[model samples]
Target: MNKKILFVDDEENVLSSFKRNLRREFSITTAPGGHEGLEIIKNQGPFAVVVSDMQMPKMKGSEFLAEVKKISPDSSRILLTGYANIENAIDAVNHGSIFRFLTKPCSNEALISALHEAIRQNQLLTGEKELLEKTLKNSINVLTEILGMVNPAAFGRANRVKRYVNQIARLLKLNNIWKLDMAAMLSQIGFVTLPNHILEKVYHQEELSAKERNMLAEHPEIGAQLIKQIPRLEDVSQIIRNQNTDFSEHQKISTPLAPVQKFIVLSSQILKVVLGFDEMIFRGISKPSAMSILKRDKSKYNPKVVDLLEHVQISEKERMQKTLALAQLKSNMLTNQNIISLQGKMLVAKDTELTDPLIQRLKSYDVSVGVQQPIKIFV
Candidate 1:
C-alpha cells in the first residue's frame, strides 16, 4: 500500500503548493488549519506522516500534532513554519512527538527526504507495537489454556465472565478491549495454587473453613502478582487485584485511574457480578433471583456497569435458540444449555461457543461414550 501523508497549513497557497509538489511522489492529503487537520486525523487518519505549519490560527502545530499523537501515536509528525525558534522547536519535539522540524522555504529534496525518513520511523514504531501485542496475546492464551486444563471450574468462570466483559465493553463503546478480555481470562489464575478439592468446594458453594476462606480471598492478589510478571500486563494485573475490592475501599486507597484503568475496574466489577450469578445458577437458583440478590447490594458495583450487565442479559435472552443434533452443530454457535454426559458431568458449559476442535471432540465422544443428543444452541 502507498504511504499516506497529510500536510496542514493555514495558507491555502502553501497547502496547494505542497499538493502540487508532492502529490505525484506520495499519497498526499492537505488540511487548511490545525482544526481541519485534527478532523482528518480522527476520521481518515493512520497517516504515515503528518506535516503541519507551526503558527496556524486557533490551534498551533505543536498542539495539533500532540492531539494527532494521542489519536494515532504511530503517525510520524513534522512541523514546518517560517517562525522557527528554539522555544517552538523544543515544544514541537516534546509535546508534538515530532519526528522532524523544517523551516519555511525548505527545498523539495529536503522535504521529500524528511518525509521518507518519517515514514520509515512510523513503520518501525507500528511494527514493534504490533509484534509486542501479538506476542503478549499469545503468551496470555497459552497460560490461560494451561490454567483451564488444571482447574476447569476456575477457568470456566473466566470464560463465562469474558462474554459479559465483551458485552459490557461494547455497550460502553470502549476501545482496546483485548486488555479487559485478558484481565478476565486470567482473573482466576491464582486458583491454580489451591487444591482441586478446594476449587470444587468453591464451585459447588460448599461451606469453607477459615483457612480455606482466607486462601480463597487471596486468589485475586495472587493472580495479580502472577500477571504482573508479564510486561504490558500491569493494568490487567491491577484489575484482577481489584476484582473483589469494594468501591468504597477502591475510592479510599487507589490512585486516580486512567480511562483504560477505569475500564479495567469496570470490567472486574462486571466479572464479580457475573461470577456470582454463575454460582447461584450452578446451585439451581433462577437467573432473576440471582440478579436481584446482586442488585440489593448496589454499593458493591458501579451502577452503570450493573445496568449494562442487565442489558447484556436481556440481549442474551433474545438470541435465537435452536435444538440441533451433534452432526448439525457449527462453529461459533453458543451453547444455550450445558451439555451433560450420562454420568451427569458437564461436557460443555452454557454460553460456550463451539469451535471446530470442540465439535470434533464431541463427535468422538458421541461415537465412544455417547453424548446427549439434540443439543441446545444459540444462533
Candidate 2:
C-alpha cells in the first residue's frame, strides 16, 4: 500500500497548496517545474502516482508525464490542468498513458478519489508483474530439473554454460538477466530428443553421420519450439533458436536494434560463445587453448563476450572434487563421477546435482539392493 504521490507544477503556491491539503492523508512530494520533477523521479521516484499541470512553463504536463512514463513506468500518471481541451486530453492519454485526466478547480473529493484510483491501478500493475516473474521463474526451475533427470550430460553442460553466461552478463552490466539465465538453462532442452550415444559421440569429437549432423543442427529449433509454448518466454526461445547462428549474421543486422531485438541478439551471442567454450573444455582442451581457438574465428563469437572469459573466475568451492558414501550424500551436491550399481548398471550420470527426490530414490534403491560406495562428488 504505497501512498506516495508526486505533484508537479510551475507555481510555488499551487505545490504548497497541494502539500498543505493532502499532507495528512497521503505521502506527498512536490516539484515546482518539470525539470526538477524529473530530477526527483530519477533520484527518489517510483511513486505510486504522478500528477502534473498542463500549462507549466518550459515543459507542459503532458510532456512531463510522458518522461515520467519512460523513467518510472509503473507510476500512474494524471494530467491536472486548468486549460483542459479535447486535444490536450488526447495528447496526454497518447503520450503519458494517463490514468486520469481532471481539470483544475477540481473538487478536493474528486482529486482524492482520482489519486486513490491511480494508486490502485499502480498496485494492480505491480502485482501483475510480480506474479508473472514468479510464475516464469518457477516454470524455469521445473524445466531445468526435468532436463537434469532426463539427460544429465545436457543438464551439466547447461549448468556450466549458465555460470559462464552470468559472468559475461555481469561484466557487461546487464540490468535484467533472468531471460539470459533462462536461455542458458534451457538451451539444451532439445538434447532430450537425441539419443545418449549420439551425445557421447559428439562430446568425444567423433565423426557423425549426415543424419546425426542434421539432427544436432535442429536441436536449437526443437528446444525453441518447446519453450515457445510457455507464455512470456518468446524472447528466451528466440535466443535459444539463434544460439547456433553465426556472429556474422548478427553483424549484418542493421544498426540500432529495438530493445527486444537487441536483448535476444546479445543473449544469443553470449550463449553461442559459452556453448563452444564448454564443448572445447569437454574435449579436454585447457581454458587458454579453448579460448584461443574460439578467438581465432572472429566471426564465430562476439569479441566482447569472448574477452570477458579472461576475467571469469570459476569458484574453487564449486569445483572441489571429493568422494563420499551413498549415506553421506546430500541434496544439491554435484556428482563428479557416474554412480554405478553392483550389477554394473549406471544409476546416475556424472555432473548431475542431487535433489531431494533423487536422493530419496537413491536411498530406496540402495536399501532394495546395493549401489557402489564412495560416490565421487563435488561439494
Top candidate, metric TM-score? 2
User: Model 1, 229-325: lDDT tens per residue?
Assistant: 9999998898888888765554564578776666666767766766666667656777778777777777775555666656666334667989999
**Cα-lDDT of candidate 1:** 0.79
Stretches of candidate 2 above 4 Å error? Answer: 1-47, 55-60, 63-73, 94-96, 105-112, 317-322, 341-353, 364-370
**Which whole-number lDDT from 0 to 100 does residue 117 have in model 1?**
94
**What's each prediction's clash count?**
0, 0
Error of 2 at 24 (Å): 6.6
Question: Across residues 238-306, which tens digit of lDDT does each residue of candidate 2 receive?
Answer: 999999998999999778987678889999999999999988876668889988989999998998788
How far residue 166's Cα lies from its native spot in candidate 1, in Å, is: 1.2
